[model samples]
Target: MLTSLEFRLLATAKAAPELRHRLRDHGHDVRLCATELLTNVIDHLGEGTPVTVRVIGTAAEHGRVRVEVTDPAPDSPPVLRSAAGWEESGRGLALVDALAERWGVDVGPDRKTVWCELVGDGRADGRPVSGAARPTAPARGR
Candidate 1:
């Protein structure tokens, strides 16, 4: 599934439910990660930046979901950094690193996409494809 959203902080709240619906089982992680990514865009790139979100699932990944957020700033990419305990900010990527199985940034000529993959056992509805719904269910036992 793919969604295009405005770069406002309000859009994050609006987009969260939709992301949760699409992700279903791992909605919380998807929502949180997506929000962090968007918040980063708003904070660094300013508001009203265009964003495209894509959710992908793959059987080869053993029930993993990949969420990608595309924005128009290839020059300003996200970086991971350690935040001091008293710091009130700079924990976005840190949270992403902790929650996402893996995350990365793909920079193009005029834009970049920040992506994160999350592992879950929930049933996915489609084969491994971009912009397609591939719900996954947890395996039996361990």
Candidate 2:
């Protein structure tokens, strides 16, 4: 499923339920990651920017869901960085990293899409599979 909307304060509120409905068991992770990505677009690109949110289900038996947030700024890719405890922000992507099986950015000529995949199976706990080899570098696509 795909939704296109302007990134606003209430955008997440509206998008969350839809994502939950589409993602089913993986709703929580998808909602949180989508929120973080939308928030990033609003914070960095300014509010009211047009963005597209996509949720795709892959590997149904394993409960894998992919979430993608596409924004108009191709040059302003998201960067994952360490945030001091004193800081109030900058933890969004870190939270995404912890929850997602894998995440990456895809840049096009005019826009960029930040995406993450979450696997809902293989762990009794909702967290990602233990000892899974997560990529140290962000995956980028043209």
Question: For residues 1-142, what per-residue lDDT tens digits would candidate 2 score against the true structure?
Answer: 2122222233344555554454444456777887788778877887667788765544333466566788889999998988999999899889889888888998899989898877753223454422222222244532
**Distance from true position, residue 98, model 1, in Å?**
0.6
What digit string (tens of lDDT, one per residue) describes model 1 on residues 1-142? 4222222223344555555565554456766787788778767887667777655555354566566678888999788899899999899989988988888887789998888777862234433333434443232210
Query: In lDDT terms, which candidate is top?
Result: 2
- Candidate 2 error regions (>4 Å): 1-26, 121-142
**Any runs in candidate 1 off by more than 4 Å, and if so which?**
1-26, 59-61, 121-142
Evaluated against the true structure, the overall lDDT of model 2 is: 0.66
* TM-score for all models, in order of appearance: 0.69, 0.69
RMSD of each: 7.5, 8.1
Model 1 lDDT at residue 69: 76
Q: After superposition, how far is residue 98 of candidate 2 from its true place, in Å?
A: 0.9
lDDT of 2 at 59: 37
